[model samples]
Target: MMIPLAPATIAAPFARYSHGVEVPAGWRLAVCSGQLGMASDGTVPESPREQADCCFANIAAILAEAQMTLTDIVRINAYVTDRAHMQGYMDSRDAHVGTPPPASTLMIVSGFTRPEFKVEIEVIAAAP
Candidate 1:
């Protein structure tokens, strides 16, 4: 099992995520490419929350190909086009991640390749 690290010397995480995670030896790792908010049907949602949901769904599918699931995720890197979309992204993340939540970071970017895209997510997972 992975170990969550939250040092007492530091402040608690600002959101539903761990500050770090320790993947044990002998576990296999999967690094997924960043996933955009577009659905397989080639449609992008107008709302940030919806877009983020799509992004996580895509990530889940990618992990499934490797015989893993969202609970195996150890880290997440996410980007949003605007600060206003942060809450929306966070909500989706909280819904999908497993207990003791993975270490995470969210950033605001100028934009994506597509103007309509509001969120993108990538993750690192490990499983024995």
Candidate 2:
């Protein structure tokens, strides 16, 4: 269930992601740190698309560790090293998210910890 918070005066939709409205007083919350596109061997994926996929995969892994699924996600923040791959990343995210896209933010950044890593993701999920 979507918890209503005090409305913000900002018009920018992306702000909804960066400054997520406060959850209801008693609602349970989950805070996940950003997930990078590193592999088991510490190797970063070569392409933006591949890195994006891995980044989401890692986020899913985090949620799973907490006994949750993507459906539990209420908000997400995505960082991409290449803006040119926005469409491709959107396609992949759409395919992976199923339906009713969660509130999200995608941004292009100058770099990540690893040179080959092209994307990173952070997620916020809630449960009653």
Candidate 3:
């Protein structure tokens, strides 16, 4: 089982995610490496919106490989190349992963491994 936590003390999360997550004992946990927006063909999208879409799509595929779903995700760490892309990032995230969201943190960085890569997302999931 997973318990999503958001203390009343801190400001509410900017979006759908919780501030923290607690996974109970006896369940298996899956920790995913950071995923970029690269597609199977080694193509990266041009716009932040497109990249965010592909990034989450990639995450879904990886979790499915481990027999998990988005609802099973307990935590996420997201990074965007520029602060200007924040809205697009959140929009894409909302379109992909909605209710029963994970505990998460989103950051803006100077750049990524590739200049065209605008977004990266990493997740932790738990299942019985």
TM-score to native of every candidate shown: 0.98, 0.74, 0.90
Q: Candidate 1 on 15-93: residue-level lDDT in tens?
A: 9999999999999999999999999999999999999999989999999999999999999999999999999999999
Q: lDDT per residue, candidate 2, 23-92, as tens digits?
A: 4456676778988877657777677677667777877888787787776677878888787867656665
- Compute the lDDT of residue 77 as modeled in candidate 1: 99
Better of 1 and 3 by lDDT: 1
Judged by whole-model lDDT over C-alpha atoms, candidate 1 comes out at: 0.95
lDDT of 1 at 86: 97
Instruction: Give the lDDT of residue 30 in candidate 3.
Output: 84
Q: What are the lDDT figures for the candidates, one per model? A: 0.95, 0.69, 0.83
> Which parts of model 1 are misplaced by more than 4 Å?
none
Comparing 1 and 2 by lDDT, which wins? 1
* Angstrom error at residue 84, model 3: 1.1
